[model samples]
Target: MEQILANGVYLGSQYAMIALGLTLIFALMNVLNFAHGQMYVIGGFVTYTFYGQWGVPFVLALFMSCVTLAILGALIERFLFAPVIKGSSREESTMLLAAGIAFFLDAVILLVFGEKQRGVPKIVDGVFNYDFRLIMPYDRILICVLAILSIVAFIGLMQYTKTGRALRALAQDRTAAQLMGVNVDRYSMIGFALGAMLAGLVGGLLVTITGVNLGMGGPTSIKAFMMVMIGGAGVISGAIWGGIILGFMEAIGLALLYQYGDITYLLIFVSLMIFLAIRPQGLMGKPWG
Candidate 1:
């Protein structure tokens, strides 16, 4: 029980970070970024190349991942999504564009990174064991702590920064924000970049634990979408709650169903369907338009 609880907390923290990025993008642009998981995989690859292969410092590698993804995200928003949003009459256009972008990124990843799994060296060694009750790896603990700190920092940025204020204003109402002197195009790009950066950050953090591969992108995106739906579409706090809930669900389910041979995810999806049917708005999310 103690181990399960500890595992839940660790997994929940990282999952929440992933969900945060997806929810942030949705809140700002109303676009479901199917490429989000690809961005994450790219981040991990960058970290693996630098920290794992080239002997660069881990911090520097992580920074490079964030910068690379941020730039890519900004360029995608500036050249692709923004124009499509303005030119298209159908909402499905954006979804289609997102799907196309996901495919493009997947191809890019395959061409550049190949199909092999990649990971980084653990940042810490040893395990934290308490009389066989609650045992965890030191690297996992460090990553979890870093993820939580990142979350708190993100929340603080949203609540107290000038750029955050501008982004929030844009998200709340684009026309009103423009009327209030906010640059909608610029802030939208910034929001998308920030979201991508968050995805990269988490990917870099988790590379030490789970590793990453080209095939993980689609499933990762699906998991993030599930978290968003569970928490409430376009709600930030809901994303966090959804992530934590899903993480614990995974932890407990896996622990309990290890003997059942991969039925845990099947159970999770079934539960999610039931939950959504019962309360579509989620725990704290208002219905998004």
Candidate 2:
């Protein structure tokens, strides 16, 4: 039980970081970024290259991952999304664009990184055990702590910073925010970049434990979407809640998997479908205006 709980917390923290990026982008642009998982994979690859291959320090490699993804995100928003958003009359167009971007990123990742899985050397070498019941690797603990700190820092940024305020205003009401002199285009790009950066950061942090591969992108996005839906789409706190809930569910399901076999995921997803059917707006989200 203790092991399960610890696993839940560890998984929840990392999952929340992934969900946060998706929710932030959704809140700001009303766009579901299918390419988000690709961005995460890129982050992991970047870190793997610099830290695992080039022998750079892990922290610097992580920074490079964040920088690389942030630039990619900014460019994508400026060149692809911004124009489509301005020209399109139908929201479906944006969704299509997102899908296209996802495919493009997948192709790029495969071409550049190949199909092989990649992992980094453990940053810390040890284990933490409490009464032999709650045992975890030292590196996982470090990553979990960093993930939590990153989330808290993000929350603080949203609540206290000027950039965050502008982004929030834009998210709340684009027309009203524009009327009040907010630069919608500038802030939108910034928000998207920030969202991508968060994804990269989490990818870098988890690469030590999970070891990223090119194929993980689609499933990662799906799981992130599940977390977003569980908490409430486009709601930050809801994303966190959804992540933690899904994390615990995964932990429990895995624990039962040996006994129950494939029914574990079936049950978990079915429960989510039922919950969404009952409350489509989600736990914290209001109906779209």
RMSD of 2: 1.0
Cα-based TM-score, every candidate: 0.97, 0.98
lDDT of 1 by residue, 117-180 (tens): 9877888999999999989989999999999999999999998999999988987888999999
lDDT per residue for candidate 2 within 70-131, as digits (tens), equals 99999999999999999997889888998899899999999998999999999999999999
Model 2 accuracy (lDDT, Cα): 0.93
Error of 2 at 149 (Å): 0.3
Collision count for each candidate, in order: 0, 0
Candidate 1 TM-score, true structure as reference: 0.97
**Candidate 1: global Cα-lDDT?**
0.91
Worst 10 residues of 1 by lDDT: 280-289
Candidate 2 Cα outliers beyond 4 Å, as residue runs: none
Q: How many residue pairs in model 1 have overlapping backbones?
A: 0
* Top model number, TM-score: 2
With a 3 Å backbone cut-off (N, CA, C), the pairs that clash in candidate 2 are none
